[model samples]
Target: MSKVEDFEELRPLLFSIAYRILGSVSEAEDAVQETWLRFDGSATRPTSTKAYLSAAVTRISIDVLRSARVRRESYVGPWFPEPLLADPYEDPARSAELADSLSMAALLLLERLSPLERAVFVLREVFDFGFDDVAVAVGRSEAACRQLLVRARRHMAAGRPRFEADRQERQRLATRFLDALRNGDVGSLQSLLAADVQLVGDGGGKSPQLAKAVSGAENVARLLGTVFPWLVRIGVTFEPQEVNGQPGAIFRHRDGKILQVLVLDVLDGRIQTIRGVINPEKLDHLGPVADAWAADREVKQARREWG
Candidate 1:
């Protein structure tokens, strides 16, 4: 295949590496574009285009992440990675290795790392880059990179678990949780959640949310129970959709307005973390979920109209 074809074939992998490191879809795309530019300008043909591209993307992501930290430090309220709608290319193997990579809990925990540590951890753990490659990409020696990984691992140990539920089991639990929510069963919600489950909302001060993270399953349950009644009063509905590669709910008001999106992080067959993104800025990529619900509504309407 031509170099152009080769580059096209590797775009998805490149984007995945960048996104995992930077945790921003837009920034990932930008990093990939920059990688292509560097590839095109190079004098020598790349020995392995994939490695070159991955290295370039990782380097670019590290720079973007460093600059992003400056901005986030001054943000209006608590910051969170913009949640992504799950795409077909999500690697099940990578997902399994990095249980919290796509989890809101994992993203929040990453905030504790320095930019270089974040890049190193993502490359080593999530993308399976070798220590040497990671060191090269992050400008560290292999031994130094190994130490960085060790430190990152220790930092994440508090949130890490010995076993994580399979995707099917997680979906099953999420479905049950959503059903209970729709049915107004507070007991069911509480039962599904881990006792210490925490709800972290990222409204970015652009929407309504508790000013700080809400902890404890019972407290989260009470909050959701109270909110659900008001939602029912307003004729709002909940729809199950995949968010950040996990089962989640999108709230749609009667007039077809989407108010919020919630993604759960399941661990050891229990709901351990809940991330609610009500911020308009973070929801922009989600793209008018009302339209998605309307599409479903249209199909249902057609079935009735035809029947």
Candidate 2:
């Protein structure tokens, strides 16, 4: 195939690799585009187009991540990865690995690793790339890449819950939870939550975030139970959808603009965490973002008048 054909064929894989490393859909797309530019400008064809493009995108993502980390250091409030509606790449052989690594929890875990270690782990562990290819992707020796992988695995394992709910069970619980939330049924919502469950919001100081993470089943359930109904009354609605391979919802303004994306992390038959990403900058790729500040005002006014 020609250069364009090869790049297009591998685009999904390249975007997936970059997205895993950078946690920003926009940045990942840029890395993939840059990879194509380098490939197109090359004087000769590579022996393995997949390997060549993968290495280029990985290296670019790693560099981008390093700078991004610096910015994140001073970021206001909690940070969550831009919500990914769907992953373009699919390999049945590595389906389990792919699904597990795409969660918001997994991406946040990746944030704790050094950029090189993150790249090595994503290429080797998640994508099942060979050691030689992994080494080339991160510009490290095979031995060094293996060492990085070991560290990444150790860090990720330390952060993961001991027993996570399977996909079907998690979906079932999310459905019930969303139903309870819509009804403002705090009792039902609490029943689905783990005792230590936490509801975290990532408005990145650009919107109305929780003053802090609300923890405990009662507290979280009450907060969701109260706030969401008010949002509904003020013309906000949510549609259940999968986000980052987990059950989630995309909330929209009355006019149908994006408001936020909420994802649930279920473990051991209960909802362990509820993550809401409301930063407009992060939501832009999903579609037209709502004015969250204005939405907040509307909610407050509706509560006072409707009550």
Candidate 3:
């Protein structure tokens, strides 16, 4: 195949690799585009296009992540990865690993690793790339790459939640949780939540967000139960969707503008964590973002009128 054909064929895999490393869909796309530019400008073709492009994107992403970490140090409120609606690449042999690593929880765990370690783990553990290819991708010797993977695995294992494997069971629990949230049914909501469950938000100081993470099933249940009813009063609606390979929902305004993305961490038949990403900058890729400040005002007005 020609250069264009080979690059296009590998685009999805390249994006997946970059996204895992950087955790930003926009940054990952940028890395892929930059990789293509370098490939196109090269005087001669490499022996393996896959390895060549993968290495280019991984190095670019590692550099981007190093700079990004500095910005995140001063970011307001909690930070979460931009919501990914669907992963473009698929390998039947690695489906389970792909699904597990693409989760919001998994991505956040990966944030604990150094960029090199993260890249090594993604290429070797998640994508099942060979040691030689992994070393090439991250610009490390095979021995160094193995050490990076070991550290990555240790860090990830320290915080990884025991994810529920039954997809139907997860969906069923999520369905009940959403239904209870819609109806303001605190009892039903609490029943589905783990006793230590936490509700957190990432609004980046640009929208409404929790002052801090709210923990305990009762506290989380009550907060969702009270808040969602008011949102419903103002014509906000949520549609269930898969986000980052887990059951989630995209909330929209009455006019259908994007409001936020809510993802659940379901484990052992109960919801363990509830995460909401409401930063407009992080959400614009999904659709036209809603003015969350205006939405807050509308909710307040509706509350006063109801009283």
Candidate 4:
């Protein structure tokens, strides 16, 4: 195959690696572009393009992660991985292990790991790379890479999901959630959410979001029904889509501008977590968003609509 064709074949894999490690779509795209540039200029080609490209993406992502953590330390609100319309990785269905590593919960857990640990985990567990390859990717010796893997696994295990998600069941719950959310049906919505359900919004301070992660089904439902009533109004639209191997939806305003892209974490047949990305900076790649919209519009909209 030609150089471009080879890159195209491995693009999804590379993108998945970078996205999982860096947790930013724009950054992942940039990393992949840089990888291509390097590949284009190289006079020598590796025997296995997949391994070479995967290593390049992994190393690039590790560098990005190291820098991103610094930026996130001072971020405005809770930082969330950029919402994905669809997972850009290996098919989770064909590989259950892949799903575990790419899920939102898993990615969040990964953020707690040091960059090397994260890289080691992604390469060894998620991508099934050999220790030597992982070592090369992270510039560590084989034994050091093995130690990193154990540490990463230990950290990840502490937060590992209780059970594998049932896709049909998760989708059913998400559909019910969207319906109740848009209908302003609090009782029904509450029924579908766990008592300790948590809702986390990422606005990066560029937009409005929960000042902190909101917990409890009542609080989350109240915020939807009373605080942000326009969410249930007729003008808004909801489109069901998969995000990071879980049931999710893309929400848009009456103006057809994307507003929120969300993912639901279903456990025990109810939504245990609700993650929404409303920051226009993150949503702009999906479509036109009011990038300049007021950060506190949730409060203003509530008053304007009610009054």
Model number with the top TM-score? 3
What is the model-wide C-alpha lDDT for candidate 3? 0.93
- lDDT per residue (tens digit) for residues 1-307 in model 2: 8899999999999999999999999999999999999999999999999999999999999899999999999989999999998999999999988888899999999999999999999999999899999988888899999999999999999996432547787788888988999999999999999999999999999999988999999999898999999998888899899999998999999999999999998887888889999999999998999999999999888878887
How many steric overlaps does candidate 4 have? 0
lDDT of each: 0.76, 0.93, 0.93, 0.81
**Best of the two (2, 4) by lDDT:** 2
List, residue by residue over 174-290, the lDDT tens digit for candidate 4: 888887887777888889889999999888877767778889988888877664446544356778888877888987776787878888888898888889888787887787985
Error of 1 at 159 (Å): 3.0
User: Each model's TM-score, in the order given?
Assistant: 0.83, 0.98, 0.98, 0.92
Q: For model 4, what is the alpha-carbon lDDT of residue 114?
A: 99
Off by over 4 Å in 4: 91-94, 291-307
Best-performing candidate as measured by lDDT:
3
Quick one: RMSD of model 3?
0.8
Q: What clash count does candidate 2 reach?
A: 0
Count of clashes, each model: 0, 0, 0, 0
What are the per-residue Cα lDDT tens digits for candidate 3 across 1-307?
9999999999999999999999999999999999999999999999999989999999999999999999999989988999999999999999999999999899989989999999999998988889999888877899998898889999998998567899999999989988999999999999999999999999999999999999999999999999998999999999889899999899999989999999999999999999999999999988899999999999999999994
lDDT of 4: 0.81
